[model samples]
Target: MDNKVPYSLPGMTESFLFHESQLIEVGLNNAQPEEVPPPAFVPPCISIDVSHLFTTDQIFPTRDDLINWVHGIAIENGYVVLITKSDSGGNGSRKAYVMLGCEKHGKYVPYRDPDLVEGTRTQKTECPFRLKGRPMKNGIDRDWRLKVMEGTHNHEPARSLIGHNFVGRLNSEEKEQVEKMSKSWVPPRKMLLTLKENNPLNLTTISQIYGACKRLRKSLRGSLTEMQHLLKKLDGDKYVHFERHEPGSEVIRDVFWAHPNAIKLFNTFPYVVIMDCTYKTNKYKIPLLEIVGLTSTDKTYSIAFCYIVNEGTDDYVWALECMKSLLADQAMLPKVIVTDRDLALLSAAKQSLPNTSHLLCLWHINKCVLAKCKLYVGTDDFAELVMGKWGEVVDAATVEEFEVQWMQLFNMCKDKYSNFTSYCSTTWLVHKEKFAKAWTNHVMHFGTTTSNRAEGAHASLKKMLRDCKGDLATSWDASHSLTCNQHTEILASFERSIHRIDHIFMFPFYTNIRGFVSNKCLQLIDDEHIRMKSYGGCDCLLRETHGLPCGCELAGHRSTTLLSINSICY
Candidate 1:
């Protein structure tokens, strides 16, 4: 059932062809009736030697010239050579060499290492099919020439070179794209999928792309260790201090970094800051603690970041102490620190910045309440009660009113819902002053009631990184890039406020605000402007919420009810 085709080597014509079965049949018919035994079978030559093609003064003029020479020697002998590796370095040689690997399916095991670890390495296609080359410095050849090694290849010569990697090397343009995207942290599979849009399908594989990426990384570092490069970078950083394992160990347990510009920003806008941690972002097996400060524009700026040994109280305490050391001034300490309800971390913050008011993330508290209430009530009615009724109580306007609504809810759920009751008395009551809206509104928390700043930062970091299992060097590089991008965005916002703002507030009070505060703060004042109509009076909660005067307060100034508008200024 086999179809036969006339075959030829590279640069050679097709040879005579005959059906193998027909040839056997014809030989049998012409044989003697006594049919003597056939001669003993002999195997073909396993490798070709080309040492005679080179001399002391010779060299390969170009890559193609070397290939053509090798092919010319083998093509006449029923073989076609393929280049497995080439290193021209722009001069078509450098210690440069082209390797000859057996074509696909032409690959075979070396005579050595038989019975290797089953399924682990024995199945690998590491054919002993390679030869090195270099330019002939003293030979008559123009640039370079290849020499045949001493040992013969242990396997039979390949029949043809139709599907060989040597012939299917990547074109110049594709190699460029692979190198570019790989450095950008683009996955190899994604690089191929993207390139395949403009090229033939199956043109490249993930293995090839990954190889190129690895090659580039190696070339960039030459022979230096990854740690050597990292330490070299740290030498230039004045504000970032790293703590590695004792004297000669390999582990990097903790590292704290505060860019000089970030320190300046912290000094300028130290009123509100937040600390949050992200995990599984690096192979170093440490948690990244991010300290973000809220700018007057309500934008988030990275104040500092550190890698913690663990998420324990001592680890967080060390991180905060490092931050304090970076500032080296108590006045630069944040007036209010916002974070999730990590009690250990909160305790550390208290010890580190005794003057700083600690506030729990309102969003986290609400989410926890919703989760527990759903489990307690286990009905649609309970969800409605928690969301509609309990939500109002949590957002109560004053401490007195909050206590009243909380008691009412407690009275309702104290007996029937054991889970709900235990959560209230044990959890909510213990941390009510930190998490509840009633107590938190008194602090100037930059209006950030959630950990979304940290969450968004984490999402951006993940997008720039290929995987969470990257080494410490990889994570540091990615984080540095994102920090640059964030600062650029912050600069753009500053430009927008100065050059592109549209001030809708025409009144004198609003004009004073527009000139005095940031564009983001102006927007907050505008929201209060809208709220004053619904809840009229100087005692409006808007003043309490944002530390800004309400329309009622402005009206009091207009009607001489207050001596000075400065009285309303927080």
Candidate 2:
């Protein structure tokens, strides 16, 4: 280092001496540097075009101006603007844009678009007034439109009007208006206060109404009690003893009154009157008489009954007299009268209605046969044979035929039976065909040929009376009521029959014809034991065993046909 500085010291000594001498005169001044005045505070210069800021229709001018104006306003507010076409319309036109500000780069970059300023005034004006009025009118209009669209006025006004009417009366003007609008109106002249407010009875309204009602009810109850007392007093005085009359007098009157009604009822039908007598357990030995009639429509038998209390040497005569009284009217005479071949009843019928036919029920005839032929008619076949021939013997052309057939039938059975030839010829033989016809038609229809209607009726009556413990009067009343009920039932059955006939019989003949054919077929099928031939008449199996066709098959067939015909005819 010492060697390197010798030349520089010689060369620089002179220069340094010159500079050092010049720098010796310069003085140091320690003064603060004047603060550079803050650069003039320039407010951010914002240029807003505000042209095309809104839609064409929505803006006061063209769409471009509205859009640009909106874009410029966005830029001034520190935003960047970017223009792009809206995809909704699929048009290339820039329908919408975004604004980006110059402050994005930390500088107040004011946009200088001369084209926007020049074109702002020339844009079309769509509706300047609408655009200006939108903010203020939109809220009010939207609320009003919602109410209108919802039809809120229709219901609310109606409810409010109804509520007003319920509250109180309207003023004079309002009342007059309502009257003018209504078809009928009458207003009260005086305004009445509510019952609760008026307190008319000086009590709570509910208590007052209740008390008034109670008082009214008490008065009504008192009136009813007085009326009842008066009625009781009257009834007590009016009560009469029904026991004062002699029993015989009452019986006479009842018999007289019942006779006419019985006669009337009997005359209405082609009825067979059946009579029977039973002895009651009494000192008087009351002869219970029952009159039965066969319904021509249904063939069902019914009974009307009464009793006579008399016992003496002439008891049969008294009974006959009572029967005669019961059948006093000629119209009451039944077409056929059936009895047990009682001499007394036969004599009474001969006396009362000489024209009326009297038949010994085949039942009585058979009983007589059995009693007489105890030695001969031993077997049921012989008994049935005898009973079967009874009708034919009665209908014989001459007495000799009947005698011949009777003797033959008797002799054939004599080996194992009693000889009943004479008995069959005499007592059982009624020469009158009409009388025999009655036995054949009515009695024989039921197996065994018995008029069990009267016997059955008597048994029922006795049971009913017995159940009452032999209280004569109670039994009599109960029997009377029972008889009435029976009559009512019979009447109902008759009415129903009438209705069925009327309703069913009015159909076409072919329908009825078919029904008749069907019934015949059914009968043929049901009566399988009955043998039929093309030429010879059919022989009912029942005839050989029961002495008759048993009439069941015949009756069923006939009833079915009749009912069918009735239905069709009606």
Candidate 3:
């Protein structure tokens, strides 16, 4: 045996250790031959030993023990086995359980039925299994089934309890009681023809009706609270009532509140309020406060109005207070207030609206000039000449130029009015700062620089009140109607004329011019001078036309020559 080979059994062969180098060589040509040995063979051997790390009872004596063991195994090896008891025979007894394999530590945990935990598996029964589906739906279905079963089984008893409680507790018959109450209650009248009449209820009418109602209530010994309650009910139902005695203020407030369109109209432009007063025949002068909005359309619209006391010694304070009330009510403070140069009015406006700029109407200035310059009427013709030819004077760039042109024209007056020139100049020219920067420019174009809007409004009110002939209440009604009607018509006309310059052109321009002339010349000049030069030519005509001097320069010209020549030529 070779040392390299291990010992073998008796059936082994020598060829097992044979190498190719040691193989017997046989040559066909030679007579000698060598045979190779067969490989060795060894018998298979087996060994058997039985020992347990833990007994079956120690590892899994109960189902919980088995489950815990399996859970441990599953955690370690990612696999598990389930053992369940089964019945071996027809007798109801536990037996050797069946073992089932499942994925260990899978995404889902298996749930076992408590009733079947210690019982044997049955072949005929459906196995409990959880599928991959919505857990909420499964829970809801189980609860609904339980509720349905309970509802069906207990329906009669629940209904009996409810009916007993409802009927046994009430003593009165509900339907009969309701019918009796309905028979006793009376329905109120649905309409009030006299109270709801179409005629508008103004302040005076409301006061009268309220007084009558009060008298009726007192005489009849009626409940005042009940009457008030009824009136309140009427107000609630949108029916007319006479409780609000002062309807004028209420109407004005409503008109302003109901239509913010008017406010929007004012806010659309730079606005200046022009206010004034006129005497109504009722022995009371009514101060009319107008909110005038200067539109981009180059037109002024009266957006709001109020009647204050007239601006006079007795009523100026009251009027101003009323104006302040109006402004406060409207929540408006204007940038500029343009009005006639009434001292009381100015003081009131200045004190109330401290931040606002006050402007004296240029129209008033012309009137003042005329009143102060009476003697200048015949000699200098300053008022008449300047009225027509002072476009350059108004357009003068500086105060110096204005004064120079003013004096040049003033000095040309006759000797009689020399003192008048000084007086007029001292009064009107002394206080140029009170007027607006645009005053002269505005007068140059529009002529009468006072807001004719106020005058027009006054005229309109007078016309409407004329029919009432100074009856205060009637006049108030008429004035109110006039304002509303005129504002409506004027706003409509303005809208219509906005695009129609032809219609605008049809309005008389000379009216404004004549107003300016009258305010400036006739009002300021004295009677004697006016009479002296009534038929005579104008005195201050520096620029002549057609040999006959202009009106002012030709005042003292014994122009019978020119008058006769013209007559003769004709």
Model 3 segments more than 4 A misplaced? 1-270, 281-294, 298-300, 303-332, 371-376, 379-395, 409-416, 435-448, 490-570
Candidate 2, residues 88-154, lDDT tens digits: the string is 2124232222222221223233348745554343211111111111211232221110000111110
| Candidate 2 TM-score over all chains jointly | 0.39
Model 1 C-alpha lDDT per residue in residues 327-396, reported as the tens digit of each score: 6577667677889989899889888888888877777877887888778876687657755667777788
Instruction: List where candidate 1 sits over 4 angstroms from the true fold.
Output: 1-63, 68-101, 104-107, 110-138, 143-190, 193-202, 218-228, 237-239, 242-252, 506-510, 513-516, 533-535, 538-542, 556-570
Models ranked on lDDT: 1, 2, 3
Candidate number with greatest TM-score: 1
TM-score of each: 0.72, 0.39, 0.36
Q: Candidate 1: what lDDT?
A: 0.66
TM-score between candidate 1 and the true structure: 0.72
Across 1-570, the per-residue lDDT of candidate 3 in tens digits comes to 444345656877876654434443324233456567557333233221111211132323343444455434423432222333322223423232324223211232223765653545221111221111111122121111000001011001122222222111222342233233222321111111233242222112333333343343344335534334434333443322122123456321111110134445544432355666566534344444544544322345555544444345434444434434433234555555667867777777777667666666776776666655544464354556655433444445456777777666665654555666576556655656555332333221222246576777667666654432332333333444554564575466445433333322233422222222212122222222344466654432212101222345324543222231111011
Worst 10 residues of 2 by lDDT: 145-154
lDDT for 11 in candidate 1 is 68
Give candidates' CA RMSD values in order: 14.4, 43.0, 38.6
Model 3 lDDT at residue 424: 52
Task: Supply the global lDDT for candidate 3.
Answer: 0.39
**C-alpha lDDT of residue 544 in model 3:** 16
lDDT of each: 0.66, 0.41, 0.39
